[model samples]
Target chain A: MSTIGEYIASHAEMLEAALIQSLPPQWNVPVSLRESMNYSLMAGGKRLRPILVLAAAEALGGSQAAALPAALAIEMVHTYSLVHDDLPAMDNDDYRRGKLTNHKVYGEAMAILAGDALLTHAFYSITQCHKVHGIPAERVLSITEELAAYAGARGMVGGQAADMLGEQGLTKLEELEYIHLHKTSDLIVFSLRAGAHIAGATTAQLAALTDFGNAIGLAFQIQDDILDIIGDEKKLGKPVKSDEKQQKVTYPYFIGLEASELKVKELTEQAKKALLQGGFANPERLLQLADYLMQRDH
Target chain B: MSTIGEYIASHAEMLEAALIQSLPPQWNVPVSLRESMNYSLMAGGKRLRPILVLAAAEALGGSQAAALPAALAIEMVHTYSLVHDDLPAMDNDDYRRGKLTNHKVYGEAMAILAGDALLTHAFYSITQCHKVHGIPAERVLSITEELAAYAGARGMVGGQAADMLGEQGLTKLEELEYIHLHKTSDLIVFSLRAGAHIAGATTAQLAALTDFGNAIGLAFQIQDDILDIIGDEKKLGKPVKSDEKQQKVTYPYFIGLEASELKVKELTEQAKKALLQGGFANPERLLQLADYLMQRDH
Candidate 1:
């Protein structure tokens, strides 16, 4: 692995540990609800969102500790979305990450509540971070506002709605782009932008990070689509052909595999360029992240 | 209605208008999620939670506008809990306030997402309120922390879990009290306490209001239990006797209806006394609220 990749992998392991440790105590939740939240949140995945926050903060000359809460908050929000997405009425997936989805394990009611709890707790987490770092309350509030906007109706939820509604037929490239941008890209953008904002980034730097995040987020989704069709079920830790079975529209379905791959390459390059313009002299880690995202086996 | 009651009712009406008018534009959420959130939020209730915040603030000699956002935040959190509770897995209720529950109308996925959105947005609202009121950032951060603790696992969610588990059988009065104290009473207490905090309530006043809130909240729950057994469905505007159908444990179930009614009366008296001790001479509105809780047909 490249040096930056190695660093991210190690950092991700630590971040995951922190996340699991931070989960609501079993005593605090119904036994069933606690089990369900753990089922999804503790399920092993690359801590991509949190890693993005850490990486962005690091790139901006901020300490990882300074960004830890933002990292945790982003992951919490992301996990919440995933938990809700796997519910019977949404993606209806029975299995995720090689195990039963939250609703299947906890029942629908607890699963719903678990997601709500996580989302609410995320903001709670962010506020606590504000306290610890002595970050100006206005800046913390600004970040909260930005994070809410991106993760809420206009951003991720909106994308999921369009995805569900648009499931009936093959979608155009523009529609697919809209879905990726809102669903996948918005939080990713927020994660990076929040890190920079917390670290007192200049307006121009914030704008650049936004562009970089947007490109990488879309590219990440495109790669995910490509993997679903070609990835190994055992390695992917879930069913490979499930999206196809559900007839969900994806970048590969619209642009063909080769075209999607090309788009991923193009977006990766653009993300790198944005990072460069944003005065990231030590772009090694971020560049490796883009490469690793595009080339992941699962 | 008494003059204070008339004032509360009128002010609550105004708060309701502000809530409706203040909903972030539909464009902020995807059309589907937007429809679901609005359906439940705009479906009218007495606006008791927000009104409590306003009254508490006014009583403490703060401007009502200073408390509006906090009031709105409390309602959003309360509404989110309701949406999640009515999901298929939780209470599995089909209707609330005589209208279809969020999941039933919007489908479970959107309902879940909508609830998550509302909870997250609540903090954003509070922060924005602080900004508008020019409250110190540290104060805003502290308020957010207080709000989170009350709403999160140790507060409302914990109560919910106990209520759900206790539904199987809560034979003791204390167990029922524990459940209500956490689930129903904590937020009510938080609502009053948070308002008092924002208004710079004296330490003595804060302690008294906290006591007052705790007494009334339990009384409120006890009255709800009484209504479930004795209330008219048409007047309640929703299903009555649902506790029996759901096999849920309640105050009346443990203490008997007559004892529960007596408890409500006692609690109301305690609440009024606490308010008086807190130096609230104009306890007119609070007394009316206590009475309304015990005597309302609905």
Candidate 2:
């Protein structure tokens, strides 16, 4: 049996190919804008969000081929948020995934446009599920609606706004939790849900996956915070204490590093419990994946 | 019988109400972001795009109610492009429609978030058509796809990118026309197509409307260029000759003013001819709108 690491790596390679296939570099207009979008998109990462999408589909007995577009769309949305968040007006980061950020290589205007293109293209790309994979129009529409909501005003973007507003200082645990829940978890949750939706998971099964998703998503961010303190900079491909440099509040700062690490363990156990309810052909991979994420080093 | 002007006014009023209803002021998380979106959205203008959507639906002998969500979606898209275009990194405008621009009122981060919110909300709004007006899931899906294509990377956003890149100045008339055709006309064309799609227009009829839309939309931009030179500031509700200040390449700047005006007249005639072939319930009204747009000062 393949280990969880191999499962993730295999899925990530498939996702990378799909993403490149989805966005052609040969569009007539927005030539440079398209290149800018490709720049950050092609930059390597774990591809965790998209991997979750495919894994959920497989657990529900769905082929990765059938679920690929939805998976790509979710990743595109994730990528767009990162690009925009790195803008000068936002997080203003200079690097991402061990490379210069989108704005650093492309001009600010082009980076902004690149982000907009990816976000908008996420919608356009998903519509192809009906065309390419013969997914029903109603299902595609439902996905589109859910994607718009989670990624837009009330979810991820709203979380970013709160994070930006609180950058000077956030004292309340609730406020920081809100940021972690919405900014980071919304899309992660969406990716899991979208995969199940493509695989025709029952309402109960979907609920289980959603619960699993939310728990693991929080745990992932907590691990990220933990990494920012104790992680190897070379392995992480970013500065360890950059979050501190930003003067932003974090889980470690609020609850202490030990408590934050404890929270990751708690959330990981909760995710395993949820997946126990999400009955499927082979949920072992998913359960293993949860364990792996909780103990992730980089 | 209501004149074309009265017809437009009636549609605009309904559109205003629908716009307000579609975007509630009460999204709690993105409070300031939602407010920034509402700020420019509620700032009064002619509401031409939504009106055209309704008009095209009516021309196809369909209920305006069926097309209303799409109309509102298009308006949201237009508003988003405006908010972003006015950003500090872009046009850097302080005013829009006689009021402070979103960035000026809400700060740059909020304005950017607002634009992102509005753009995402557009898709969410249109999904309601199936539930609210009994528009079929397939038809709504088609509209969603077209809107995504035209308003996104290949269309409106692409145009905006081209316009920004040419801020130093575009020399060729073709370059200026490319900017005008994509930036200004893409959404307008989408509005016309959306109304037709909702009404189930025949292939020939849809093609004719698209032709008319392309012509009239480009002409609208040309007239806008003329207005920048000769328009009343109080009436237009913004600074005049600001395009010159931005060093933007305008139709009047590329060609002599006389030739530019001549092109508008020619495009207006071509639009009327397209409407002639369109075979609608009241092509006369569309023709009148074309002529009015050609001659409008503001």
Q: What DockQ does each prediction reach against the true complex? A: 0.61, 0.75
List of clashing residue pairs for candidate 2: none
Model 1 chain A worst lDDT run, 10 consecutive residues? A24-33
Candidate 1 docking classification: medium
Error of 1 at A79 (Å): 1.2
lDDT against the true structure, per candidate, is: 0.80, 0.84
Name the DockQ score for candidate 1: 0.61
Write out the backbone clash pairs for model 1: A109-B89, A109-B90
lDDT of 1 by residue, B1-298 (tens): 4564577679778877776655577455567777777777787788888878877877777777887888888988899899988877787889888888898888877787778777876787787667788766666676687787778766788778778767778778888888888888889888887777677777898788888888999999988888889888988777888888888777887778898889999998999888888875345666677777767664
Give candidate 1's error at residue A30 in angstroms: 4.1
On TM-score, the leading prediction is: 2
Error (Å) of candidate 1 at residue B2 is: 6.5
